[model samples]
Target: MKDRLAASYWLHESQYAAMSSSAVTERRRAAMERFESEGFPTVRHEDWKYTSLKKILKAEYALSSPFSEADESETLEFKDIKRFLVNDIDCYRVVFINGRYSSWLSETTHQGFDVCTLGSAWKKYADQVEPHFGRLTEGLGATVQLNTALAWDGLYVNVPAGVTLDKPIQALYFTTGEQPVFTQTRSLIVLGDGAKAEIIERHQSLTEAETWTNAVDEVFMGANAHMHWVKLQHDSPSAALTQHSVIEQKRDSHATVHTISTDGKFLRNNLDFKLVEPGAEARMFGLSLADGQQLVDHHTRVDHLAPHCVSRENYKGIFDGQSNGVFNGQIHVHLDAQKTLAFQENDNLILSEKASIDTKPQLEIFADDVKCSHGCTVGQLDEDALFYLRARGIQRKEAQALLMLAFAHDAVADIQHPSLQAKLHRLIGKKLGVDMG
Candidate 1:
């Protein structure tokens, strides 16, 4: 055995690979090889300066494999959103419990859409799936690769050419444990030419368990295709989550991602897009609310490799109760990629002096004929905005919450899903001390 493969003995290689039929085995081997050279990432690493995993290492949490949860109520929530068809209609649904897929609560009845267990798809499309399945996680860093190496049950959704899904496909990942447990989920979504669809990825816990989920999702948009993604993450105080997403946009296609994070002990997310062809368009929008010592981080990168492409990004968050947050956006424009237009912005509000934020918005351009700009702002509640609202007879706490929500409305209103928008609004309202339900 090689040196990298040596430490892998601590992990269950085969059982972990059993979840998705994709080229997980090969990716696992490659990741193990990489892990051999670079053990675990430390705070010394630039991308992970604020997030410390040493505490987790000492927590003694079990590395969750294919263990069954007999205590779970066997209930899954896909229609957790009002307008979602995944709960009521013929929309496809995939449910994963504690990092494993439960077929009993999932279905694949959508016409013209091929939905299969990640394991099954791997067996048939090993060659195609192997190459891209682990690419994003590998580029993401340590925890993500660890997720790819240990993922057991995930889903693969493929929408064929010109086929528009009737309802937003839903993926719900839930947990049912008390101790500190770990879960890594991988999903691959491919939208063929001219296909249009909405995907809702929801994360919640059954028992508010002290769990950690390192999830990676990759989307490939073919020519002229359009794809919308909504991610909702809310869990107990003991839960920690790290999610990474990579999107590839082909000629004349559009890809958009909206991520909402309100509850978690520690959470970090990485989102990127590669414009490989002309006319490609990409947008990323997110909102986060952190309270009670929670920490949330979001990092994004967009590479303009071709000319005549466009990209936009916006992220906002509210930090309260000594919680912390971070946002880093790096946009790259390559030479010869003329006519490229890209804009990135990050704005944050701190509800308390104890709350903190680290914001870095960057731009690296090698093209002379391109237009690219990036900026970030870290500030407290707009006193003027609050006073203005209160001048109109609004209460103090209520006025502050309203001002913060108004600051966040830009990103939330951009969401195209009404049901999802309402859910997120309620969550934001709750964070602002309003009755969400």
Candidate 2:
């Protein structure tokens, strides 16, 4: 299977060579070699013990081709496309259909900052993208390497020093085709020193056909830079997605990431952060709601390499029916990372007897002056809280929804954007079959 999949990329090698820079071509070749050697990860792998890729690997998926004139004619209805967009937001939009950028459905800028596709960045802004394009994925796993080798187009944003983007940027990837296909995408976000920016990412499937997405993101934060990133995953049950995000923070940089997973057949997210200099801060929050034999897994790691750095992580999960959820968080404070402060918490609620969760929060503190702690809990809904809400004349279903909302409020409240927060609340309410108002 590994040989067959690796050989498939040879079909696109000529196209990739023509479109990509020499540096990118070399990186792709190296990544493909690495993937060929490592192959797919299995349950035996410690990092993938709780998740299985048997079904995903068994299915034959057609690789997406580059966008062309014919693809322009395959259009979707406005009403259908509008449902996936965030309403009432004055933000720049970049939309991708079938793993290809859709210029008609996108709004991008290149005047002050770059809001464009990775292919364009590689060709037009080679000087700015070459250094950090594939630097962060040096030691990543096989899935990421596969993406690096086959990924054709994705979003790219660069914020210059001391400049704050006037509005947020949204990157939407929509899958719509006749047959089941696999799409690989890679995104790069670079923020210069003292720069501030907010980015939103989403993956949605327009058709019920089985589709798999393998994506990788690399974010670089310069000294004193600030970034807020939100990822929304609410695709159909036939959609399967695996995403990995690598974040590198310099001195005094701050970054916050929110991952909200409400729907999908199988979802696996790997979030890794590295604090390269002192005084850096990293925050991670995640919420997952799964039902009907679905699976959602989150693996996160934070590395403190310098002194006086801080990191915080909180993740919550709600599983119904026979669904399964997993959360593994690791915090490592190196010997040189003195006076570091780190905390991690993972809490889960099972709504049915068949529902299950596996949570592990670990902390490794090698610095004597650092303070670090980690904890996790898995349990059912709070019966007492549900009863209280029922006693107040709320219906049983409404009361359950209210309780679940309250349980997830702590993480939702951390979102700094009011519009985005409100949108998420509505999405959560819709998923719970309740009215948040």
> Whole-model Cα lDDT per candidate?
0.76, 0.87
Best by TM-score: 2
State the TM-score for model 1: 0.90
TM-score, each model?
A: 0.90, 0.96
Task: Kindly provide the TM-score of model 2 when superposed on the true structure, using C-alpha atoms.
Answer: 0.96
lDDT of 1: 0.76
- Any residue pairs clashing in model 2, and if so which? none
Q: What tens digits encode model 1's per-residue C-alpha lDDT throughout 145-192? A: 666665555768778899988877788777656666666777887888
Q: In lDDT terms, how accurate is model 2?
A: 0.87
